[model samples]
Target: MTVDLRDRHVRAVTPAEQSPHSYFVFADGRLLRVGAGSTRCDPIAEVPSIREIGPGTGEGRESELRLYVHGPWVCVTERFGVNAALVNTATGAVRELSRADYHADVSSYSIGFLDRGGRTLLVAQTRWNRLDVFDAASGACLTERIGEVEDIDYFHSLLHVSPDSRHFLSNGWVWAPVDMVRVFTTEAFLTGYEPTSIPVGTAFGYNWDRPCTFVDARTFVLALDDEAAEHPYRQLAFFDVPGEPDERLEPHTLVSCDVFPRNEHGEVKGELHYDPESRHLVALTDGAGAFLVSPAGEVSARLPDLMVGGHGGQAGWSYAPRHRVFFRWNGGSGIEERRIQDCDRAEP
Candidate 1:
């Protein structure tokens, strides 16, 4: 299922929750459905308001608009403010979820649908270090962290909910901006959370910010670059999503990648995706190319010549589980699909 979207000039894109073959993309001044195996961009609806607020648009100067899609629901949010909206593509209904106050910043807060069913919404504060869950339908706060901790900010950034919806991981930073990763049990935190009293999940120090994806409900992979070392290298570390909030828990295994090219930022810039059916991890990079990695720290397949683009920030580089293929902008004139081959599958 390969779809060439190089000419589309996508402003924002997110993988459709149910259909791996299709993606919701904002391009050509409208919201359209771009899918695999074909190059046609199907029109969904005219979203003039959404388009105007998106990056590079009139309202985007102050903040960037991000999209999160699951099933029939699309959650739109501003990168720097709490203002958010939930759109139902099925019914063509748009609902304003929250309006921004005045105190939002890079570390303010962000919103996303918490579960696959789109019943819950997750509100995480990047600067204040608070997490809140809300009822998507009623717009009611379901659970929230109470009793704030002064001067101890977790600065939660990219939040990854486990496949089972039992836990979540925050690939965020701390003071002085040290990239740290933390995991938390969803039920425990939501049941009776007190920020000062609760033991937040295990915190891993020095794991610089790259992209990470959950392999399963209890396991995930984190990207690491030994940048300060004499010979810098890229590595992927695998960890069991800790059952308790133990800060000392370390990655059970690590996969060392071949020394490869780097982006202008002096890093192997890319995104990580996991195939649940094949149980494999795929790391796609713009400069160094892509690799098919197993859960057991094995490099099963490597495509070194594949130069990718449109990977970071609001750019979309995603793996569609339904088609078992990776969809990414070629950074040129095409959207390439990299399918995970079964013959290359390695046992973990």
Candidate 2:
């Protein structure tokens, strides 16, 4: 089911809906909302009630929306900082979970909601190498000082919680002559817990231009300039996070050819997404091509018609029962619904 680009049925959101800060797809696609500047706007004509959640007051700047969905409750992170807010869509009640109440020095940090053993948990990390956990429902402190490490600087890289909620992984670069890639896990750093060093090496130096994402518990997909040449080459590598030094996984280059195009300034622009279930890696190139890779690092499918812009515009389809939807943005203005069917081959 390919949606036509010229369909007049497409709705235009109000000027308020154009916020690049807090756009989200919620309610299983029934709601398409955009929150930018300070106000949240419902762009779709289907949901007309514009209920204000709260004022956007914070510092770090809202990068993405970390929506925690458990049963009937939905919690959203603040525009910036370590603020977890609980919002009931049924009643529109909003509750703020502040870091001060938890007795943790988390003035500057980011948070993600995790579901641990059927209970909602808030996982946060501070700039000074401190981790904290809070009860999602009551905003009560669960654990403070989960882990403390000195000298390693976590420069705002991607922080991901595993599907099982048993571990949290952070990918960042340590401050050195050459930026080194490092991954930190919750299993190695809980309070009263001894830090266990994973046998993973510096995958690559920090190059903000390249795109990267975790595939599963021990695997990651990254695009890098393998030869340190002018043009960047995209590659996919899998590593064992908990394996020994000799048992550590080796990095493999899946794609050796040029996959992305250069911008007006001659900089390569690309985005990547990996499906852990199928071990399928999708690379959306700025040159208008999408490359699908297998777990064994093989290109399975290459769709040249798909155009993915930047890092945040890419979407993944779950293939458990194949009961999911596929949509893509045509530009900054609208989205095109691609397919609505069951995905029996991908992960959620």
Candidate 3:
């Protein structure tokens, strides 16, 4: 399905009811609001309720709020002190998934939501380097363990699950300071399993963050940062899952533009979306314009007049097979629904 960018309209949600930092959209077109402020879309009955899952650093600054949706259910994770919750979206039900009792010194964490068979699973990573899973319906933990990490803070990274719900992927640092991508199977987890690293050089190193969706079970893309510096760059790289030995994942610098300059200190400040069905990759950058890349990594379209940028947070653009409407998030603050019209499927 090809979306017409010209027929789109954009609007911002009221800022008073939103948290300046945290926001998420549910699968059913309902928005899961967050942050320290109250939302006009308050008391989201059919959506997950936001509450202080853990203790904060005195002033109660929330670290992260993530919403995971599968089918009709949405699971929300609110991280504060050392606790988190797995809430049911269909009903206003909340259950504590983790607390300070699990990891005393846990100062940071990440959560991944996956649907295994007919059940929903909530996986939590504590600041003390521990991974735990809980039943989404009952909040009963199925497994827990102290992960293979000495310093938990360095483990800060992104978590993504496969479309098939068979594999879970995480990118972060473990024993060493080098970046690593680890894959775990849901089937193995049910029988007491842990993630295994693909290979040595398969994971992108130097600097990497902001993971886009999985192009397939084996291919995924991430925004690259400079190798030696802390700055980010407008570069994309593709690596085979279960990577081959000596395989080096390098950035595609040809995609960079004048706004997204290729420098040792430039960062890829924007949002990325991968359309699985059409094999289209859309990149919205602060410095550059909105660009569409073919599955082969060739530029297909660029909308420079609609240059919009921010922290380049979560921007939604998904193909609704049922509705036939290509939905997109307008600047991460509002949504723009566009009807897909007839367009040539030939590669541009």
Compared with the true structure, what per-residue lDDT tens digits does model 2 show for residues 213-296? 666655665555454456455444455455432423346445454455545433444666665545566666755566665655
Best-matching candidate per lDDT: 1
Candidates in order have lDDT scores of: 0.58, 0.44, 0.47
Per residue, candidate 1 scores C-alpha lDDT tens digits across 1-348 of 233455556666666778765777655545567665445666665554443342322234535556777667777656555555566777666666543342344432445456636465655442346656766556677664346534445566556767778777666666665666766776666664423222223333444445678888787877765464564353767778665566445778667764234444445456787877667677766665567767665667766544446434324455555567666544343345666663254222
Cand. 2 Cα-lDDT: 0.44
lDDT of 3: 0.47
- Pull out the clashing pairs in model 1: none
Better of 1 and 2 by TM-score: 1
Which candidate number has the best TM-score?
1
Query: Which pairs in model 3 have colliding backbones?
Result: 54-81, 55-81, 232-266, 232-267, 233-267, 233-268
Error of 2 at 229 (Å): 5.1
Question: How do the residues 174-216 of candidate 3 rate in per-residue lDDT, one tens digit apiece?
Answer: 5444556555566655544343323224334433334355667
Candidate with better TM-score, 1 vs 3: 1
Q: What is the lDDT of residue 295 in candidate 2?
A: 57
